[model samples]
Target: MASQNRVDLDGNPIKPITICMIGAGGFIGSHLCEKLMAETPHKVLALDVYNDKIKHLLEPDSLPWADRIQFHRLNIKNDSRLESLVRMADLTINLAAICTPADYNTRPLDTIYSNFIDAIPVVKYCSGNNKRLIHFSTCEVYGKTIGSFLPKDSPLRQDPAYYVLSEDASPCIFGPIEKQRWSYACAKQLIERLIYAEGAENGMDFTIVRPFNWIGPRMDFIPGIDGPSEGVPRVLACFSNNLLRHEPLKLVDGGQSQRTFIYIKDAIEAVLLMIENPARANGHIFNVGNPNNEVTVKQLAEMMTKVYAKVSGEPLLETPTIDISSEEFYGVGYDDSDKRIPDMTIINKQLGWNPKTSLWDLLESTLTYQHRTYAEAVKQATSKPAAS
Candidate 1:
């Protein structure tokens, strides 16, 4: 479609606007950059400390959208360039955060600082400059659902009213302060509150996105191959590393915590809708997720095992998963959300956005990519002689 013919949800023709996309080298950022370049006439000032994931889009100056995107390497923490970049663009999307679960408990201070303190300036710059802001927050901010506090056998535990997290209705619940796992969530919730206050008190145009486990290709790095050998990544990458090395998936505390996942592509579509249709999206905290794709971590592991086996052309292991206590895997002060099922009413009505992928189908595609990308690397790493 031509830029002239591009229309938003309300039939308003969308204008080409430059977007200052912080953390543009991350998984979601990379995908969003691709979408904008391939489909829209909008320009992106991509800012991130690293461009490894988005190198494909940056290099080969002869590419069609080469002129449409520019990568600037800078850390948002203390960089004076952040404010200027935010001023340069009509819209700012803040996707920078320390979101990995492993760091939440072990590196609580860094997690809090990265997620909350570092984001303070971004929010301020957008508000001060009167720029439209699309801030990415995690579904973790919702913390554990109310139903989780109910008795294990209680009938209310199965009720949607108890567990379904509504952006407008549900309360944000977190464990005691000592849990430390809630550090990231607590920081995010604070930042979100600050953003809301800015919107209300200062009349800043802002949209908050609480993503529910957006997963797909180019997500967190594979162990040893890309990231630190001992670093623990998100659940999908953790399981992918295990599958790649033909090792049993480790199930933290029997992996009973349930979560809903949306394909990164599907979620990005919703984001694009928010970007184009600001009238409907602004002043609204939207939950971007596929409620229909809910599954316990154990179920996710089983499904991933099957999908990896099929994709890799390898036989399924007799013992595909091993249960380990959270203390052993994540260290002390670890906690988890009992369930996360985003209420889709607001997003559906506001943006007409609904995630379209099924769990099995998404796992199939993701696992196929994982196998193709990391299987050989894992094989080579494992074949190397052990260090003395």
Candidate 2:
């Protein structure tokens, strides 16, 4: 029997169990699934728009409790499909949305409606089922508090939602609303409001997680402001690929924007921790990230170059100043965050959860993964030619 706003744990009320992740195929989602499957005894369901392209990411065999998790092909926009999935789940974590800056910029309409509008049914389903809902929110919502050293409680500063955003930060501000793409933040803020309202009025358990700049494997760290097809232009991925090809790392816009990057594993762990403690998480918001480890773009490029040198057995090539001519979302010469860090005081003390993965450890693991994968790919390609 279901209680007022909480679902009973495993037919009992002690250790609440059972969870369904909406976008389990994504980077953070995949990591979260793996973490949950290993640590918890709960029945986990991983849902996504199953496609051949991302099949490896969704493979149940990759998780510890492969038999426990059920993957379903889903498009949140579809009402019936969403309703059916939401009905069977005890707890729901909606990580389905266009999360990246490139995505928000290129597909603004899809980002806005699919996240804010289409997800209405999912939230309603959680409320109706008396199950807990964990909605994924980005730190990008804390738009440009650049070098401002503003805490979570600071007055909301006006900036594009696709940039340095926070969870508690406001979506609306006084300015030429058209100048910046406030639509993305506006949409998320609207959904947050909607969920909060439902949680209060309908007695539903809902939690919001706002993650800061997170980096790791499976992250499409490519160049260009558009989607994946554009190219590998991101400093990290680009540097890794360059090392593979024995090329010099290219620094764009002098690589000055500093950002706090949370390791993929740590980020996923925080999500699972929140899910397990639904009672504490209900109707509460937490900033999930490591605020201490902040690195600038130039520092990132240098670090990648150093990592590449270790694997490639080659000296670091002299990086040259490359002019970014592309007129995409992260336009040319556009100054990004000087230092965007989070204050994890609340999450750490209350939840007793802190990011364990260090920056060096994270970067080394990333470099190693890229190195091994690239080597395997090259070996396969070259060996095939010889066999023929």
Candidate 3:
């Protein structure tokens, strides 16, 4: 309701712009779609292979902004309609990709194709059509931090210069070809290069977003419930499923790897700023994440255990998590970033944006959604299948 009086940073009334949102049914996309419909007058040409996540927004025509939103059910990989959709909109936001870590090593080919190859035509379409493009790259593109290579006891590791990922300054270091965990990161890096090349040679207007661990409700599916039984989503959903099923969270490599998480709602605000402030955003790569909410994977698991107990009235597990080697958990060729703390200089300077939610507060809200939405279903699923 407060969005009725929206204005740009320069005190200019924000004009509604149609966006061709590729992968508009994923975690980030669903939230963005919700924000746009509720808060802004913009139109979304929602594109994705699936629409289960955004189903509420697409149907019945009773909800507001129904006319302003359309679902294309388009796959950028082989879809013939990608170009036309990009050309029709004022901006094309490509969020389509295979981002989960499980598939990176097990399904490297699909990972590469989805993350990089599939994105080529989308980039080309936007460039050729002269449509402004906002490509959703990942913090995974940063791969690993410099401090990760140093001795564990090295005091130099404390220096922010060694670890803080900066959009303009940080080096993109990834594991070797064998450590196929880098497949997604490598693919994303290549695409980022290609996008930069497009901007340099073809003069494409673009903004690249590198999001740190943004987690909240409707993030990912719980395996054997809404998603495949063997599906492994990011850390949040992974731990949520374990908690809901009364099982221990699986920690890989002692869960020592550190990460920073921002509330998805907070992160979406940064994206909206990028969407409206093209003058400030274009030709820049923004790292949108909360450096203040840093924690180890083990710490995250422990925190979630307590949070779920509070939300669902369930008792916390005595041993909330079980540690396993990277080889056993992720299989061979899997590696992880030691840390991911975004240095917010670029995004702050460009969009005047900053993430606000604390980790514990974000997790509390997220677990409440998880318990309400999936706890009953998880109970039924884990029940012995009705004795056949």
Candidate 4:
């Protein structure tokens, strides 16, 4: 659709605007950039240290939207260029953070600094310059459900009111300080509070997005191929790597933790609505996820195993998954959220947005892409002679 034909929720025609998208090379950022370029007429000043994931969109100046998207190679942490970038754009979207679960406990200090301290300047710049800000927070900020504290045999644990995470109602619960896994959540919560305060005190136009496990192609890198051989990515990439190598997916702590995943394409639609309709989105925290797509990690593993077999035409392994303790997988001081089902009332009432993809359907398409993109590389890598 052309920009002229685009209409806001209130039936107002949308105007083209430049967006300063920090961390535009990351998974969510890449998808947002693609959406903005392909579906909307907005220009993006894409800032990130690396552009490998978005390289497809950046090159070949002859591309239709070439002039609309420009990549700036700079880190937001200390770059003198950040403030000017924010001032030049009509809106700013901050997506930079150390978000992987592996880093939350193992690199707690870095996680805290990246999620909170580094983001302070972005919030400050947006507030000071009167630029609208869209900050991407995590569902991890909800920590654990209240029902998780109930007795295992308690019937109340089955109630959705006790377990469902609400943007406006739920409490942010975290484990003891020794459990460094909450570092990321703590930092994010603090930053969220700061942003909220800025809005309440200074009337800054802002929207906070809490994503619940948005997964799809071009997510985190596959180990030993694009990322470090020892690097541990999020669950999707982790399982995808295991499947590509024909190895058993390692389920951490019996994989009892439950998660709700929304397909990236579906989640991006909600974001676009938030972007184009600031009247409905400003001063709101939206939980963008598919609540109906909830699954236990073990269940997710099994589904992925089945889907990968179908996509790659490979036989299913007799033992598709192996259980590993949290200490062995994520190191010491690790904790996990028992369940995360976002209360969709706020987002639905405000933006009228809902996720549409099913878990199995998303997994089928995602696994197919994974197998096509990496199976050959994995085969050659494993077939190589060991260095003597």
TM-score list, all predictions: 0.99, 0.78, 0.98, 0.99
Kindly indicate the candidate among 2 and 3 with the higher TM-score. 3
Candidate number that wins on lDDT, 3 or 4: 4
User: Which structure is stronger by TM-score: 1 or 2?
Assistant: 1
Which digits, one per residue and each the tens of the lDDT, describe model 1 over residues 1-388? 3255899999889999999999999999999999998889999999999999999988899988899899999999888999999999999999998889999999999999999999999999999999999999989988999998899899999788999999988999999999999999999999999999999999999999999999999999998999999999999999999989888999999999998988999999999999999999999999999999999999999999999888889999789999999999999999999999899999999999888999999999999999888888889999999999
Per-residue CA lDDT of model 2 for 89-170, tens digit only, reads: 7888898876554344456688688769877888888888787899986655555554254454655433433334344553
For model 3, the run of ten residues with the poorest summed lDDT: 1-10
- Scored by lDDT, model 3 comes in at 0.92
- Top-lDDT candidate index: 4
Relative to the unseen true structure, what is the C-alpha lDDT of residue 24 in candidate 3, on a scale of 0 to 100? 96
Instruction: Give model 4 RMSD, 1 decimal.
Output: 0.7
**lDDT of every predicted structure (CA atoms):** 0.94, 0.65, 0.92, 0.95
Global CA lDDT computed for model 2: 0.65
The residue-level lDDT of candidate 1 at 271 comes to: 96
What would the per-residue lDDT of candidate 3 be over residues 125-144, giving only the tens digit for each residue?
99999989999999998888
Q: How many backbone clashes does candidate 3 have?
A: 0
Please count the clashing residue pairs in each candidate, in the order shown. Answer: 0, 14, 0, 0
